[model samples]
Target chain A: MSWLLALPFFIPITTALIAFLARGRKHLCSVISITGCFAALCVSIAIVTLVVSGGPQAAQMGDWQAPYGITLIADRLSAVMLLISAIVGLCVALFAISDINENRVKLGFHCFFQLLLAGVSGSFVTGDLFNLYVWFEVMLIASFALLVLGGEKIQLDGGIKYVALNLVSTLLMLTSIGLLYGLTGTLNMAQLHISLAEVDNPVAISTLAVIFICAFGIKAAIFPLFFWLPASYHVPPVAVTAVFAGLLTKVGVYALIRTFTLIFPNDLGFTQNILLGAALLTMLTGVLGAAAQYEFRKILSFHIISQIGFLILGLALNSPLALAGTVFYMIHNIVAKTNLFLISGTAQRLAGSYELNEIGGLYKASPLLSTFFFIAAFSLAGFPPLSGFWAKLLLVKASLDQTAYFVTAVALITGALTLFSMSKIWAEAFWKPHPQGHCKSLYSLSVAERLQRLLPVSLLASITLILGFMPEPFIEYALGTAGELLHPDDYLEAVLTGSSH
Target chain B: MNSIILQTATRVLVALILVFSVYMLLRGHNYPGGGFIAGLIAASAFALFAMAWGMEAAQSALRIPPGNLAVSGVALAGLSGLMAIFYGDGPFSGQWLTLIGAKEEDGIVISNVLFFDIGVYLTVLGAVLTLIFALEEAS
Candidate 1:
């Protein structure tokens, strides 16, 4: 059973080694990468089924007891997270086969790609806080390598800012973890939950909670700490940016949700209010920043920050429904956002540039590409009958149920602003005539090349459509995860008593 | 590329460092000297070798690219954990076996835990050397 949890990360780490070893053999590397991702996907599905049917599962490394040895736990949240990550990972790996050129692969792009997947999978399943930190570093290091893989001057500049800010946040997280350990005398999250309750000093715990907020806040790219995101995210290739945009900040958001719900539930008054204020600001500022951008990818990058605000809003509400809404929104946004980036990549290939002013006529050149852009872009903007609409509706309803009128208004306004920026992209990149009156067409590409590029884009877009049309099961799952999170007794018992199944 | 004295010292130092690194790796299970430090020591020996001789000598000495070495290290370290799974234990659970003919009074033991340590030793050494060699050769 524990092996099921380990396989998600283990498959990727091992595949990375094999892929790197077979560096010059593109066919071999692709085979290894694809097979690894497929295995991880299968394992994730199995683990999710077990969690949904049985309950949370845990396994101590080296057979060590709880609160002593490193542990891996797969509760509802972790299982769902792993399932989504594997899905995106496999898709991106397939996409990269055609999207990434020969020179980049020779620079170990496939290796780092798998390593990043390993890190994300590890982050989801880890049962200890320090182990979580280790996973963050794993993800961070791989991301840094991926970000600057091309060694272009602009990428290096972006990479420096990305690393510098994240390093500061990492140090801050470490400091808080150290303090939390001193306070509770344990690094295991379940143990910390119990130990934190036993502590008498609310002031000290509150201070430590603030440190955690600052740390994860920066990583999550909430307002005032989001400068690094827009600066760095657009510099990487579309495939790299797609994965980072989809997973990286979400890890920060995941940590925030996990910590606030499990460890610091005692002082919602102090933390929730702070989060509410930040959430509103993040939404407004992120959308406004997007409105100011002309590059297709740049606009999408700012949207990542704004969408994070909606997710954070659900966390601040801290109600069961609100948390469930956040979970649903997270799933919806990841697929939709990643598809948008992937579509932008194909569009860029046809349009001959990412700059909106220099490129146009895509709608006439390739209506197929235009349709993909429409579905993804509008879905991101919360258009009705699409995935984003449902995600936004849940959040709006959650806010209304709590009578947080201010938050409700902010969310709606942000959605409107998002639509505006997305429409701006549509008008510039797709709807309008080319500034030069001519643009390359996707139809010009070979059949195999076209399929390789559009396969992942269509796959992800279909998922968004499925999540929209058939949202009942996903909603039920999210609510169940919310219930488990709000009441963590099952997770605690699973780890403390060893896995029951 | 290097002074005669420096080249002479590198040869002896490299051999001594490699031997000491093995000692540290073996003792790491119960002591402070572990795979990480031992790997660093081994990498430093090669780094010193690279400095004394040219990049070509270091390349010939390694006999494989540092990138490939790091890849193998990661694979070895990860596979070591699978030993427990075959033994019907949890992932990464330690599996031990006593030598078949050894007497109890011999005071020596062997385990899969040591395999994991060796994997770590290789990973750190390979990864560090990869980074240093890339920068050195590029410059």
Candidate 2:
């Protein structure tokens, strides 16, 4: 159980080394990578079990204690996050197995993908803030490689913007870490909590808070800082874009929630309201951006920015209910976003073009693919009886509890716009008639057509449906996780106390 | 660019760069000679080395992957903080034992906090190196 958290860290890296050495052995490499993913899943499950059964676990690396040696602690929230990352990772691994091979059997793709997984899984589980920064760099570097895996013209353009923006964010984050250490004389997350709990310099504290927010905001694709996301994410392959859209931005949001609730609690007055306004604007603008897009993946990319706003809104509300909502919303978004992007890939694969103007009436051509796409679309739009609806409900309820009528109204309106954008994809691709002149341009599929495409799509779509129908486990975990995050004394104690480690 | 002139010039430049980086690093304890400066200075040494030699040659001299350097640096820095556990000084506790130097916070505060600076230096060097290498390789 103690070693479970380390599994996610070690497996991807080892597989990456193996894949790197095996260069041309694509099949073997993919198999090994999938097994690594499986191990991560099993490890995550054990972590949850240990957290629930044993209450929580923290241990210092190399027998050194906290605020000193590095600690990898698993509290309720970390475990829950670990579990969700694993589940989503498993789906992505499956999708990538064929996706990477089919797209192009390049060494860079597999090597970078494994590295990317390692970064995400490690970020989700690590206890130290500095380690979190390093892990984020790991993820960012790998993602930079992944984004440009094809070395396409558009990808390079997008990659340039992505790298520049994120590099700046990392600089901000590092500078803030240094200043924070200079101010409070500590870097351990828990230690900082105790160290700065009553530091009286409001000006200094708020400045650091703003720095942290701007740094994370760029990553989370928040209101004014989000121009890079839709522009960049739209250019990658559906598989790449889906994973990026699903998991990457949320890492920023997760950092925000962790830092705000735990370390930067001194100046919630102005900070909370500004963040709240940003959240509302992020959602409204994102959906409107989605409304204007005619491309399949671009709209989904825009919604990713929008939905992230909903998640952050929960954190801004700062109540336990809102925290729970944030957690629930994040889980839903990851699965739903990934599934929708894969569907887009599958759609593009079958229909031959991504432009909805030319690629209409896919339903008539491939009913199974269309059905899967519809399920994912409905989830993205937060339709009733879908998991997205529940996540959205939690957010609305959380906002209402705080009596933030304006935010609630903005969320509700954005939900409608979300539905509208999704319906356009549904209408343009599934209902509208294909162009008679370009009929000959459509791609031909053989007997194994549905088998090749439907399995990946159906698996992801079913996971979304299952979560929607039976959200009890996820909700319970989210509640526990949110409670632990909002009141992180246990997390603080875990790192600072020798026995806690 | 014969092998002799290149090798001798590169070696001297590298030596000079390393000395400069160390100066920046240690001096940063009180002034600007902290981890960030140190890391950059060390990385600049390597960058100079790469410029004089080739990427492959310079990387070979590194004796380990840049990524490992980053991880180890982070670990070393973090290890310093965790040192408090053994002393019961609480997390990130500072131990202000006297050293050979005078009672200045600059030299040998005998604190775990100083230990973290070393970690930061290595991490910065390794991270920058990794990025430069990746970018060069990508291009």
Candidate 3:
């Protein structure tokens, strides 16, 4: 059971080593990376199955008991996150084969990519706060490398802003961890949950909660702290940006959810209002920012911020339904967002530019590619019978049930604005005549390059469609996860009492 | 750096520091000296060597790319943890074996922990050297 829990992260690290060793041979390295991601996906699926059948599972490292050594626990939430992230990792790896150049491959792109996956998986499964911090640093270092892999002037410029702001967040996190440990004398999350409840100092606890909000808020790019995201996300190769878009900020949201629900569930009155305001503002600012962008990836990057607002909105509502909404929305956003970035990459390939004014005629050149774009873009914009629609429906319903009419209004307005941005991209890039008078079609790409690019996009789009069509099981699973989160007795027992269900 | 006196002193100091690093690694399980500290000490010795004899001479002496060495070290560390699985324990559970003497208490007892430490040692050494070498070459 422990091996099953550990394999999702362990496989990626091992793959990273092999891929690094094989970096000189590009084909072998890519093959190793793709296989590694597939193996991780398979392991995560197994974990999800185990967690569903048996309940939460926990494993202690080095044979040490929990609250003493590192524990890896997989509840329904962790299992689902691991599964989705692994899927994203595999898709990005496949896309990278054609998207990445030879120079970057030799520079160990596959190594860092696998390491990032390992960090993300480790973050999802870790049952310790310090362990989560370690995983965050692992993720940060790998992402920084990936962000500036080519050392383009633009990449370097963006990487610095990304790193500089993130480092501040890291510092705040460390300080908060230190304060929490000094107050509670434990870094183990389950143990902290118990110990913190006994601490009578509400003021200090509230202060610590605010600190956590600021730290994680920066990472989540909520409202005022989101400038770094749009500045940096559009600078990388589309494959790198695609993976970052799918998994990175979502990890921040996952952390915020984990810490707030598991560790600070009793302090909701204090954090909820703050989160609600941030969520609404984040959605408004993000959609408005997207409305102002003409660059393809830049627009997508800003939309990531807006969608984060919705995820946070679900968290702020803090009902079982709202939390379920958060989970579903996250999964939907990761798929649709990643697929959109990938489609943008393919669009750039065909139209020869990411600037809306510089490229056009994609719909006429390749109707298949245009269809793929419509599915991903419209899904992102919350069209009916699509994944984003269900995700938005859940949140809107959650807000309405809470009688939070303001949040519901903001959410609906944001969704419409998001549609406006998507249509702007469609009209300029796909519908209009090509500025250069000739647009390269998907057929222009070699058979292998075309397969390497389109397969991931199509698979992701199908996933969106499937989720749209059959959200029942997934919604039920999410509600179950929300129930477990609201009452973390099983998680506590699994970690603290050294038991696995 | 070109001084004969300094180079002679470095030659002796390098060997001594390396020996001490290994000693630190071996004694780490029961003592404060551990793989991380020992690895830093070993890396410092090489950094000194690179300073005294230049990076080329240091590279020839190491005879392996630092990047490859670092990656292999990580693999070794991970494999050491996975070793517990063969014994039907958890992923990182320590597996012990008595290498010599009559009993586990009296003999030279070793465990997967030592291998894990050694892996950390190699990883830190290789990673630090890789950074230092790149910086030196760039400058």
Per-candidate iRMS values, in order, are 1.1, 8.7, 0.9
Clashing pairs in 3: none
Q: Which stretches of candidate 3 lie over 4 Å from their true place?
A: B103-105
Candidate RMSDs in order:
1.4, 6.8, 1.1
Worst 10 residues of 1 chain A by lDDT: A492-501
Highest lDDT model number: 3
**On residues A1-501, what C-alpha lDDT tens digit does candidate 2 reach at each position?**
334556667777766656655546777767776777788878888888988877657766555677876777787767766777766666666667555654444535666777888898888777788998999998999899889777789999999999989999999999999999889987878888888876878888999999999999999999989988987997866667877887899999989988898888767987898789889999999999999999988898899989989988998998888888899888788878888888887777766688888787677776767778778788878898998888888889988888888888999999999999988998987778776433222236443444444565677788789879998887887888788887787677666766542
Q: How does residue A483 of candidate 3 score in lDDT?
A: 95
Off by over 4 Å in 1: B102-108
lDDT of predicted model 2:
0.79
lDDT of 1 at A153: 95
lDDT per residue (tens digit) for residues A196-224 in model 1: 99999999999999999999999999988
The candidate that wins on TM-score is 3
How does the DockQ of candidate 2 come out?
Answer: 0.07
- Cα TM-score per model: 0.98, 0.81, 0.99
Q: Alpha carbon lDDT of residue A152, candidate 3?
A: 96
